[model samples]
Target: MRDVSTLVSKTDELTYKVPVGLKRVPWIETLLLSSEPSIRSIEDTVKLEKAFHDASLFAVKEGYRRLAALNVPAVRPGDFLAETLRDDRTMAKVKAKLADEAARIKAVEDRKRVQAEKKFAKKGANKQQKKKFQQTPEDDDLKNLKTLEQRKDGGYSGKAPKSKAPKSKAPQSKGGRGPGGPKGGKGTKRSDGGKGGVRKSLFKKTSGGGKSSRGKASGRRFKAFFLA
Candidate 1:
């Protein structure tokens, strides 16, 4: 759940010198933006130029020591990004190269975020021509629901999914609409009976053209007296 940590001091440089920072440098990314002269594989040396572009990071003796043992060829800036993403070893390096967070919880959180970004980048590269997966409000709700389910399964006693929801995979009422509507569109209603319906109130309806009543209106026409 967290990065188990201890306090660090000047004497801890060898252990406390966390890995390199992963902030993207635009200038370094230029070579990667190109398709020509691409990096053929993950360990491409040419692409190391981008990593070492600042000299300070690349010049680190530790960096050279690690790079020298790698089997991949040199990569271009663009190629480096593309390859590092799919490589698990590189992903570990990525997490290692993060800034220090005073709290152990924050450091662990930062690691998770960087890992997710790398996963996203690798997925993107795998399908160069496919549409990007954009997050939406619906996805937010779905993620929340999944999280809740996991929490509950782990000996967690909390509110359950509303009892009104049928045990079956039957569709249930959605938005404000009736069972009769377009097959599927903005508000696709569902039903406990399996077939979905537009969500609507039962006891509320029209009473007639011009005339109206409170409890349950039977017949009516769309005109002036249609109070909101």
Candidate 2:
């Protein structure tokens, strides 16, 4: 009740005596050209020949059933297995059997190949899905650019997405000069010249060979230089 395909599949797993064809030519040719008879000369060649000849004679005297079972044609009772393989009708049968077996084996291999590809494809799809899920989202700037790419004119139209600017802190005051000045005062009085005053020069030639001296004993050196 098995289908033809199923039967053929089973045939691939079956063991059998492989039919010899042109593949046996080299072996037979070597045996024929050898200087001496092989070790099994009598057992293989002579014995098989005697058996086949006797079987032939027996078939002539009694029946064809035994000859039929031998699976050899009566036209030739070969002296050896190789000779039996060389027969034209026998070679044809061998070729047919080999072709059938080859087809079955090829079918099995094709099935394995298809199954392997399906498995590999499934694994690849899973890997791609996982990789897609693990990837991070694009930056807001890049996302905006991509949106521009999708527009009809293929250019950025409206204002680009703005980034938040850092807040400016008020500057600290030095020397109590500006709005950040000390809470207690109208600011310290400068020694060089009070508030808006200016000094004329610090290098007015002194009566002592123009040698420089401190103008006043003020704690502010920068102011004293200008005032002198």
Candidate 3:
């Protein structure tokens, strides 16, 4: 009699653990213990789905060992003779099952090959994109400086209008009151006769210039009178 108090472990898939005694038992005996009438699929019904179909495959795979050990010929329904003594119609069905397994293997291999090719193609396209980016006119050192400026000014896009106008021909003027400037000319012109306009009155006594007031009165003196 079965021990009704024994705790059985239930798997998440709804299959319970085979009892300790049942575990690793000959697959043929396991099938005999099952209550299923036959092993056939309406729509690819699984072992767990069809109630004891697992026992059938297990037994089918171990057909010779089970029957020889049983010492009885007609004890099991899915016998070695059941498949072997079949007509031409059954043979065709069995070969077709073999073909399905072959097709499934080939499909998996083809899918892997396609994925690998696509991955390598994408890598090559990435390299080409980087090369094209490096070759653009925007990659010039001076152009890049302008791009940096534009980015600092909050331009998210790198695009900028090109300046086609000719560069300025005139010299860049110096800042802060140039010497001999618009406001005052040098003293050289007044005394020593350098180019351009009259001297600044402030620097008129500079070297190599004509006489100042101190030199103008060199031979002159003033007379003084006194009374007793």
What are the clashing pairs of model 3? Answer: none
lDDT tens digits by residue: candidate 2, 2-33: 59998887888773433586434442232222
Evaluate all candidate structures by whole-model CA lDDT and list the values in order: 0.48, 0.54, 0.54
Q: lDDT tens digits, residues 97-133, model 3?
A: 7678679989999999999999999999999999988
Clashes of each: 18, 1, 0
From the highest TM-score down, the ranking of the candidates is 3, 2, 1
Error of 3 at 197 (Å): 58
- Models 1 onward score TM values of 0.13, 0.27, 0.29
**Model 1 quality (TM-score):** 0.13
Candidate 3 accuracy as lDDT: 0.54
Please provide, for model 1 over 1-228, each residue's C-alpha lDDT reduced to its tens digit, 9 standing for 90 to 100.
543453344336543232368445432223223223434565754355344444444334433454455542443376665644247776566455432223576878899999999999998896764534555689889988887877767854665566585565434345333344444333343444422232233323445545356322442223212321
Error of 1 at 169 (Å): 83
Ranking by lDDT: 2, 3, 1
Show where candidate 3 strays beyond 4 Å. Answer: 1-32, 35-41, 45-54, 57-86, 135-228
Error of 3 at 61 (Å): 8.9
- Stretches of candidate 1 above 4 Å error? 1-102, 129-228
Better-scoring candidate (lDDT), 1 or 2:
2
